[model samples]
Target: MVTPGSPRGIDVKIGIVDYEAGNLKSVETALRYLHADYFISSDPSVLKKGDKIIFPGVGEARSAMRILSERGLDQFIKDFFKSGKPLLGICLGCQIVLKSSEENSTYCLGLVPGVSREFSVEMGLKIPHMGWNQVSIKGSHYIFRDIPDNGSFYFVHSFYPELDKSSQVIGSTEYGIEFSSAFSVDNLVALQFHPEKSGPFGLKILDNFIKGAD
Candidate 1:
């Protein structure tokens, strides 16, 4: 098994699953900028060999789930989480980790106990909450280790996860209402914001994740 101090000869393989729906390129660029050893693949075999898995998405939940099902990625993702390795989900990717999503009434990976619903546009709010927003971090997590408190991160999403208090919510943000911004529980972790586009603070979070991975 891999550990923090595993042999230096062993290179950690980070697998970013390509679901053909999201900003895959940008996520790859971010990892490249960090000089992280990673690979992009849709193959379950490659994913099974991943030291850590990052699921990034940006599109309709139903359509994304359809693609996942068609490619047999649904079961692969479930098994990836079951391996107890680090898993980071960004944006719509984060929504799918829960039990279900109101966006298209789709069932999700059910790794986390929660449901995602669309933000009320009737509140005179933007349909997709875009641009930079500050994240109010709650508990101490390794992911945010060296990041400053109340740091701003880029976000673009119409739906957000409604989490149970026991879910170990580590951060939150305000956009018409307070919502879960990030969470972690044992080996499973997720972020509602795009760390790849969140600038320096975001990179620090990624660094923390990479460093903490076994």
Candidate 2:
């Protein structure tokens, strides 16, 4: 949880993983607006040094996995999570945190059980759940401290993670079916939506994360 304190001297070194498949610039700009001390790196060493890490993606799951494997980041991410430092995965980045993905049958970081699968065409809903959507909080989480219930956030994805109910699911949203939109277990935090583009509510969420890093 975040405690009230001076925003300056926070000294929080946040690392945003550049796996070569995401909108990292927008995320970095949002953090900069919040005065967060951060850097963008694909190197495992720099990532390991971060007090917190943000994994953001905006492309295919298989391609993203290929990039991570090609750069040997798969193992680095796993080891980093084991270190108990806070990690926030966004968009397809959140899907890779799971055990595997059905998109290409590729193994993932396995930080969480279950696999990511594409939304069923039979559901008759849009393939990609794009545009703004409201995410209902399922439970109290440090990330949503100052955010309101049923807050709208921007999202763009065709696939969604089917996490086990036993896992800590902190937020949910409905497209064709009710599915997890965000979740956190210990230091691993993930969001299927793009909070960086979600306006003031999104900024508050980032602020809470930075404050908690202290």
Candidate 3:
């Protein structure tokens, strides 16, 4: 376990899964700022050893799933979640963790019971929905420990998760329509926003995950 307030998470190792989908530098920078001990890798063998995992990405769904499958990370991630360890997902990572995506009709990890759907063009909003948006907290979770209700977080995506009624929707955002912005299931927590780039509150979210998540 990582001691709280330690400069380098004294005993914790966080693995940032790199499946050739997203830019990892921002996530790395945030972890470094939190004084976390982490490594970025695509190897399942290496990632499996981490005390916690961060799965973040930005890209088209089908292509991203293809890369994960090609590198055998698809199954590895599923197994990791089944191990009941702390796992965090962001953006595309959050989308692909669902059952499938409307983006090119891609099949996803199914860790969460949902499907990713593209925002309707008729919504009259921007395509990517890029920028800081407010996330209304819907329930309690370690990741939201220090975050205020309706705190704004950075988001960049064209698709959003349409979770099952049985799924826990912990955060919701409105962009012409109300959509799930965050969800938690057992040891897994995912967000549609980018906490790393959302400034102080965002950092707080990451901090909570690193130091407070069980």
Measured with C-alpha atoms, the lDDT of residue 39 in candidate 3 is 97
Regions more than 4 Å wrong, model 2 = 1-9
Rank by TM-score (best first): 3, 2, 1
- The whole-model lDDT of each prediction reads 0.84, 0.84, 0.88
Tell me, what's the RMSD of every candidate?
Answer: 4.2, 2.9, 2.9
Instruction: Please name the candidate that would achieve the greatest TM-score relative to the true structure.
Output: 3
Higher-lDDT candidate of 1 and 3: 3
| TM accuracy, model 1 | 0.92
- Please give, for residues 1-214, the per-residue lDDT of candidate 1 as tens digits: 1222322334568999999956888988888777788899898887888899999999988898889988888899888888888888888888998889999899988888898989997889987999999899887888887787889999999999888755479899999998998987778788999998888788777767777733
Quick one: best lDDT, which candidate? Answer: 3
Give the TM-score (vs. native) of candidate 3.
0.94
Supply the global lDDT for candidate 3.
Answer: 0.88
What lDDT tens digits, residue by residue, belong to model 2 across residues 62-155?
7888898888788888888889888889888888899888887778888998778889999898878899999999778888987889989999
Better of 2 and 3 by TM-score: 3
Give the distance in Å from residue 16's predicted Cα in candidate 3 to where it truly belongs: 0.4
